[model samples]
Target: MAQEYGYRWGHSGLTADFDLDGDTPRLVRLARPGDHDLKGAVEAALPLVDVVLLGDGTGWSGPRFTGTALGPRLRHRAHHATYGDGWHHLTVELQDPASRLAVFVEYSSPDGVPVLRSRVRLRNDGAAPVTVRSVSSLLLGALPSPDVLDVHRARNDWLAECRWYAEDVRESVPDLGREFHGHDGRAGLRLAGRGSWPTDGHLAMGAFTDRTDGRCWAWQIESASSWLWEAGEADHHTYLSLGGPTADDHQWRHVLGPGEEFASEFAALALGDGFDGALAALTSYRRLIRRPHPDHEHLPVVFNDYMNTLMGDPTTRKLLPLIDAAAKAGAEYFCVDAGWYDDEGGEEDGSGAGGWWDSVGGWLPSARRFPGGLRAVLDRVRERGMVPGLWLEPEVVGVRSPVAAELPDAAFLRHEGGTRVTEQGRHQLDLTHPAARAHLDATVDRLVGELGVGYLKLDYNITTSAPGHLAHSRAWLAWLSSVLDRHPGLVLENCASGGLRMDGASLAVTQLQSTSDQQDPLRYPPIAAAAPTAVPPEQGAVWAYPQPDFTDAEIAFTLGSALLGRVHLSGHLDRMTLSQLGLVQEAVAVYKSLRGDLRTSVPFWPLGLPGWTDEWVALGLRAPVAGATYLTVWRRGGGVAELLLPVPHLAGLGDVRVEVLHPSTAAPGAGRAEWRGEGVRVRLGEAPAVLLVRITAGG
Candidate 1:
C-alpha cells in the first residue's frame, strides 16, 4: 500500500493499475463477480483464471481439467468484508450455473506487510456427490511489460537446499517469443511438487522481475502436499496461476458429498521494488500467519548433541559431561540426539545391525547405554537449570523393531496390494488409526511425566510416496495439537532428515525448525545466512558447532553463523580448553542479550542473496526500534579485506554508530568500520572469521 498502484475493488470485480516506475498507470483486471458481463469482460480484460475446478466435462480450452484449461462458468453470488489493525479480509462466493459446485475465494492482506493471500473452497450443493479434481488457491493477471522478464525459483533437496536461479522467461519456453509477435498461444513455465513431501523436488515458490522496471512479484504456496504454479504469457498478457493438488499431479480426486466442502491450501503474493523488497514482505507475512506461541517470545538457546558432537550415538558417560558443559555455556535446552534407545550394543560398536534407524520404535531407554537409567541423566540436566530433551522419529516403525509386529496392520500405511510401504529399513505409521495414535500418545506422556523430559526433537526420516499419505500428515498434526493442548509446557522441535519436512503446516504446530543437516563449517554459511528466506528468523535453528580443534577465528565464524537466527549449540564442548570454552560462553552471552530484539526484527541481506560458495555472506535483522540493527558477517575462503554493506533504511541519516557486539577484539589487522554514504565499510584481516555488528543512529 505504501507504493500506490491505483488498486480498487467492488461487488462487480477488482482492478489495479501497476506503476511500472513511470507516471502512467498500466491497468490490470481481476475476474469479474457475476456472469452478467463475465464473457465480455473476460475477453476485453484478458483475466487469468483464479480457481480451476476439474470435472468430467468439456469447455472452451479443451479437456476440462488438463493444462491451462478453462473448466466451468462461474457467477458471483455474494461478497463479505472484515478489517483489523494492519489487515483486511475479503471473501467472495461463486456458483456454477449448470452444476451444484460452488467456489468461495478468500483474500487477506495486511497493511504493514505488502502481501496478498488467497485460498479457495469447493462445495457440493446437489443431491448427488461431485468428483472434484482440482482447485487453485491464487491467480493474478497483469499486462505484459514492454521488455522481457526474468523468472526466479529455488531448488531444494536434503543437503543442498534453498539454491536459487534466475533466467529469461522466453528461454525456458520458446513460445513466449511468439507472444511478442501476434501469436496468442498458451506458453509459459510450470513449476510444481507432488506426493507427501511438499518441497522434495522444487520449492512451492516463484518470482518474476521485469527487465524494464525494477518492480518484482513473488508467490509462495503453504501446503503440506502436492502443489503447482504456472507463469504464462497469453493474449499479450503475462499471468501467474498457483494452487494445491490436482488430479494430474497427485492422482488426487476427492468426492464431495452433498453439503460437503473442501478448502485448498493458502497461497500468498507479494509485490515490491525488487527481489529484496519481495523477500522482506514475505518474511513479515510468514510471521503474521504463524500461530502464536510463548516459545517465540522466550527465544531460548538450545544445544543438541548431533552435529560434530556425539553424532547420533549418545551414552550416559558421554552425555553427563556434555550436559554440564552446555549449561555452563548458557544453553537452556539440552537435547540428547539419536541412539539413546539402542539396547543391542554398547558405545564404540559400529555394527550395521545395531544402527539407530533399524531399531527405532518402542521409545524405551537402552539399559546398556544408560546403566543407571535415562532418568538419571535427565535429572542431572534439570539440576543444571536446563530442560531435558530427546530425539524421536515418531512417524516410522523400524522394520526390525518388535513394535512393528505388535501394532496391527491398520496402524501402518499400505500400498495398492495391501502390502506395507517400507523406506530405508522403516515402515511409515498411519497416525489416523487409533492404535497408532494411542501408541505415540503413551510414548510422549511417559517420557514427559516419568523421565521429566521437557522437550522433543520430532524427526521424520522417511517419505510416503504412495497415495493416502495426506491423511497421515493431517493426523500427525492433529495428534501434536492434542498433545500441546494437554501439556502446554512441553516444547517440540521439528526435523526431517534435517529440514526435508519444513513446511507451513508443520511449522504452525512445532516450536522450532532445524534449518539443515550440513556438517562442514565452511559449507554451512549459505544455508544459515539464507534461512530467513523461507523460515522465520526466530524459529530458524542454525547450528553453532565450535569444537576444541578450531582456531580462534574459526570458533568465531561458527558461532556467528547462528547470531542472526536461533542459536543451536553443539560440538565437543567437554574437550575444549578453558580459554576456548570462555569464548563459547561469550558468544552465548551476546546472543542472549540480543534475543529480545530478534523477535521483532525483519531480515535483510546487506550483500545480495548469498551463493553456495560465496567468500563473504552477510545477514542483517533490522529491529523496529529506531536506530537498531543486528548484523552477522562471515568471511570465508579468500576475498577483499574491505566490504561495503548498504543500509537503505538509514541512508538519509547524517551520522551512525557501529560497534562489534561479539568477538570483543577483532583479529589482528582487522580494520575498524566507518559510515560511508548510505552504507558501512568494514575490513577484516583474515578468512574464516566473523563479526556481529550493531548499527545505531548517531546524534
Candidate 2:
C-alpha cells in the first residue's frame, strides 16, 4: 500500500481518504484511483467544517448526531474485504455514541473495470427515531484541474433529445482570484433531475475533462427518480458530490427507527485519459451493472408500426401486409404499435382522432380493428417467422376508461386531497397498491403466456408529482421485476413519450430503449449517433423508416442510421416498390451480420459528439475483437464530401481494409475510401448519403 496525507492506495487503484482529520470520518475518497497523484493537494484543500442546518437550528453532516452526550462528534476507521472475482468492498463506519446514530460509507470496485461504486447507509440504534434530511451518495475531495477543464452535460427534449454540450468550466464559473493562499473562494455548477422521469429535463450524467493532461472523470447516478450532482472548487481543490432523492428536491425524508437502516442509490465514477476513454470505461461499467438478458446477445431487429409509418392506427388490414414486408426485410419481431387497444370506434369508422388516448386501460383486443381478433394478426406474425408483440402504456388509465372506474382510488396515484392526478389525458397508476400490481401482472401473463406474445413495448406518457413520482418508480420496478422473473423469455421495451425514462435504473430492467420519437429522417442521425452516450449500443433502438417516396440515397441514409444500433424498423414498407424494399432488405442483412459485434462494442466519435445540424457526422463502434471496427458516416446537405476520420484504436494495426457492406445498389466504388496514416479517407460524391463501413486489419 502507498500512503500519503493519511490516505492509502491499494493495488487495485482504490484510494481511501477522509475529508478531515481529528473529526468523525467524512470519507471523501472512496475507491478513488491512486495513480492520479494529487493526494496532498486534496487533503490540504479539505473543508474545515461540513454541516447541514436542520429545522432545529442544529447543523447535521458527516454522520454525527446533535444534542448528544458524545459532544456531537463521531470518529470512524476504514475496513475492507474481498469477494468473488477480485471485487473489493471498502467500508467506513462513523457513529455518534451518545445519539446512537451510525452511518456507513461503502465502496465497491471490481478488478480490471475502472469503476468506483459508492452508496451511503444510515442506521439508528437509539430508542427514538432519527430523521435524515440529506445524505450524499458520494463526496470527492478533489478532481484534476489541469489548466483548462471542460464540463459536459446532456440536454433532452421531446423529439430532439440527448443533445450534448461541452463548455469551459471557468467560463461558466469564473475563476476565484488566486491569492497568496491560492484560490480560497468557491464556485460551483449543479445538475439535477426532478421527477419520475429521471431523464426528462436532462440525463443523470456529467463529465469533466482536463484538457492539459487529456484526463477526464465521468459519473452517473443510477436512479429512477430525482438525483443531483455538483462540481465545485473550494480552497485550491475541486470537489464532486453526487446523491439521489433529497428533501429539497424530491420531498424525500426518511425516519430511521431503532435498529432500522436506509441505503442511498449507487453513484458510479470512472477515470480515463480523455472523453473517449472515459466514455469507454463508463460503457463497460454500464454492462457490468446491467441485469444480464439473452436479448442483449440475440439483438433482434424489431418492426414497430409507429414513427413515420402507421402513426398509432393499426388494423388487421393495415398490419397484415406490413407484417409480411417486415419479415421480408429480416425483422425478427413485429410490434403492432398504439391504437391496438382502442374500443371507442369500429376499425371501418375509426380515424384515431380523439379517442386513442382517453380509451386506454381496457387492454382488450379491438373487435373492429382486428376483425378476426388480435390473435389472428399475431398468428400471422408468428407464421412469418417473427415474434409477436404489442405496445402498452401499462402505468396509466384514461380518465374515461371503464377500467379506471372498476379499479379503486387506491389503485391510482392520488394527491393529498384524495383527487387522482391526471396528465396528458391519462391517470397514473400507483403500482405500490396490490390491485394495481395484480392488474399489470395479469396483463403481462395474458399477453405473454396465453397469447404467445414474446415482446412488450412498455410506454409511459406523463409525469407524476413529487413523492408520487418516487413511489410510482419503485412500484414499477417491483412489478417489472416480478414480470421478468415469471417470464424470462419475454422482452420489454421501455419508452416514455420517447426517451424520457431512459435512465440506468429503468434500462437495467428493459431489453431495449427507443432513442427518440423524431419523425424526420433528416433529423435522426444526430440522435442515433449520441444515443450511446445515454444507453448501451445494443439497447438503443434507432428507427429505419424507408418509404417509397424517398430517394434511393435517402433510404440508405435512414437505414444506415439504425445499422449502428438496435434497428427499430418502421416506414411504409407495405406501400413500397420491390426495388425500394430491396434496399431495406440489404440494410437489415448488414445489421444482422453486425449485431453480434454490437453486444461487446463500445462507441467512439470520429467527429466528436454530433450537433443537431452538423453537415458531416461519424460514429464508430470499436469491437472487442482485434482489429475490428464498424463505422457509420453520414454526409448531410451542404457538407463537405470528403473527410478524414481518425481511428486511434486501429493506429498500430497493420494494413487495414475498409468495405461498404450495405445497400447492394451502391456501386462497388460508389464512395472512395482508403486507409491513410492513422485514419481513413472517405469521399462521397453527393450529400444526404451514408456509408456503413466494415473495417478490419491484416488486409
| Top candidate (TM-score) | 2
Candidate 2 lDDT for residue 518: 90
- Per-candidate clash tally: 0, 1
Give the poorly placed runs of model 2, Cα more than 4 Å off: 5-22, 26-34, 44-74, 97-99, 178-186, 625-627, 665-669
- Report the C-alpha lDDT of model 2 over 352-395, residue by residue, as the tens digit: 52376876887888887888899999999999999999999999
lDDT of each: 0.76, 0.78
Tens digits of per-residue lDDT for model 1 on 1-699? 322333444221222322222221122443222212212222223322344445444333532232233323555566567777657777766666666677787778776456778888888887888776777777665534313778888877777667777888877555546535655444467787775667776667888887766666778888766778876654445667778777766777677889998887788887676787777778778877776678989989999998988887788888889999999999999999888898776553433125667768999998878888889999999999999999998989999999999999889999878889898899989888999999999999999988888899998877876666766777888899898887788889888877676777777788898788888888888888877877888999899999999987788889989988989999999999998999899999999988998888878888877888789888888887584887778888775488888988888787688888777664553435677878878777678777788888965
lDDT of 2 at 670: 55
TM-score against truth, every candidate = 0.90, 0.93
Give model 1's TM-score versus the native structure. Answer: 0.90
- Against the hidden true structure, what lDDT does model 1 obtain? 0.76
Best by lDDT: 2
**Candidate 2 similarity to native, TM-score:** 0.93
